[model samples]
Target: MEKNDFLCPHCRGHLRPNNKIILSARTPDNKVGLILLSPELGEYSVVKHDSFKIKEGEHIDIFCPVCHADLGTYHENKNLAKIIMIDEKGIESDIVFSEIAGQKSTCKIHGDQIEDFGEDASIYTNLWGATPKY
Candidate 1:
């Protein structure tokens, strides 16, 4: 895997394909959809079917398309989903990001270092109790 390849934390399956992260998503009302997320961190652009409508503050349940694993970190942070990121050098890190629609928050945690991105990132930094390093 390269620097931006995302993986399912539970099954270690590749989540990104051809520069996009493919995930199975469900709305609160049980509306199912396929979401295409940008692989680049901090890019909030999404591509989904018009039938699957999500509100700004709506909480989405993201899953791994390959293993069907629920990616939400319910025990740790309910608003976020966890994934594994394998960098170009083959180092893996835990990547957590907001699952809330319209909320842009992403973090990369490797050992004791934390790197945060997006405006809403601060909403969960305190949950880890560690300051984000540049």
Candidate 2:
């Protein structure tokens, strides 16, 4: 949602919510989708039909569209990305998602453990359609 603003860890540039998720594999061919979670509206929404693509068997590196910082990347079928998450309180954290463990998110500001739901969780979960969008 627009309620939580995502800032780049390296440059502090505002990371806008991307309705499109693009997945690129080692090969050139990629898969795309437009579905996403709108923290603004607090529900699921479809952005565009032509974007948010995902490769079937490729590891993905999610990046900031503004500053182009490497946010996080998930391994093939791992469902985890080492991305930064900013909460409604403006606290920043590193979020790692996993199929077995659900999500392990830690605040970069205080190096404290972060909760896994509510406004804070949106940062790690709403990545267009790129698998585990966190």
lDDT of 2 by residue, 15-62 (tens): 444532221122124342222323332232324345445434344444
Model 1 superposed RMSD (Cα): 1.6
* lDDT per residue as tens, model 1, 1-134: 44567889888888887778899999999999999988788888999998889999999999889999899954466888988888888888988989899999999899989999899998998888789888
By lDDT, the best candidate is 1
Best by TM-score: 1
Clashing pairs in 1: none
- How high is the CA lDDT of each candidate model? 0.88, 0.40
The residue pairs that clash in candidate 2, if any, are 1-39, 1-40, 21-52, 31-53, 31-54, 32-52, 32-53, 33-52, 33-53, 124-134
Off by over 4 Å in 2: 17-37, 40-48, 55-58, 73-79, 97-110, 117-134
